[model samples]
Target: MRLTDLISPDAVFATLKASTKKQLLQELSDRAAKLSGLPAREIFDALLHRERLGSTGIGEGIAIPHGKLGKVKSIFGIFARLERPVDFEALDGAPVDLVFLLIAPESSGADHLKALACAARMLRDPGLVATIRATRDHDALYSLIAQRSKPYAA
Candidate 1:
């Protein structure tokens, strides 16, 4: 699945002030709740539950925290660039600055995995990650993700 297919411009935040991994997930979940109009607490709780299983940090200063929620009708994503790096227990043992939060319908099966895989593949590109880090506004950041995720569309 294309990143743009799941994320709206409103879900993107340019400057996220999360001092730690927990706070970062909360911030992202809150944004997703706002966009989806679901209870913020419920979303936060669901995402937190997923994190408890394991850290979503994919390494290289990036993390993709994802969960399934009953209230959601489709997959949704939120992108955030933290003002400072935070320990996310990443595989590379490095802190994370860029985060991608994904929420999918509870009934979704392979689609959720497909979306996460698509995001991970897109984020694996160093140049694209650098470009995303350089983005100074939400619109620009959303555009960058949209552009990068285009090639994977099927």
Candidate 2:
């Protein structure tokens, strides 16, 4: 499925205030919980559990933190562009400025991996990432993600 299908325009944060990996994950988890109708603490704990396994920072100013939760019915996503880069322990050792949080149902196995792959592919495009980073408003960022993610739609 497309990332836009899981992420609403309202859920996109154009100016995230977080400046550290921990804070960024907490903010994303809280947002995902509210959007998924689950408790923020529960979601936060799940994300933390996943992070303990390994850092999701994929480098090039991008990070994808994902979790599989029993409470969710389907995969959900939250995109955030931080106002300042945060030290995310990325593979390339660069700070992250863009974060895509993916939350999926515990039962979704292959689909969850596919979704994460799609997100990583999309964010890896230099042109697309540049456009998204240059976006000044929510609508523009949403539009960019929607257009870029169309090819992966189910």
lDDT of each model, Cα atoms only? 0.85, 0.87
Report the lDDT tens digits of candidate 1 across residue range 54-137: 889999999999889987888888888887889999889999999888898998888888888888998999999998888878
Give the per-residue lDDT digits (tens) of candidate 2, residues 1-154: 5788889998899888996788888888778777778888878888888889988999999999988888898888999999999999888999999999988889988888888998899998999999888886988899888878854643
The weakest ten consecutive residues by lDDT in model 1 span: 145-154
Which segments of candidate 2 are over 4 A away from where they belong? none
Each prediction's total of clashing residue pairs, residues at least 3 apart in sequence or on different chains, is: 0, 0
Off by over 4 Å in 1: 151-154
What are the TM-scores, per candidate, against the unseen true structure? 0.94, 0.95
TM-score of 2: 0.95
Clashing pairs in 1: none
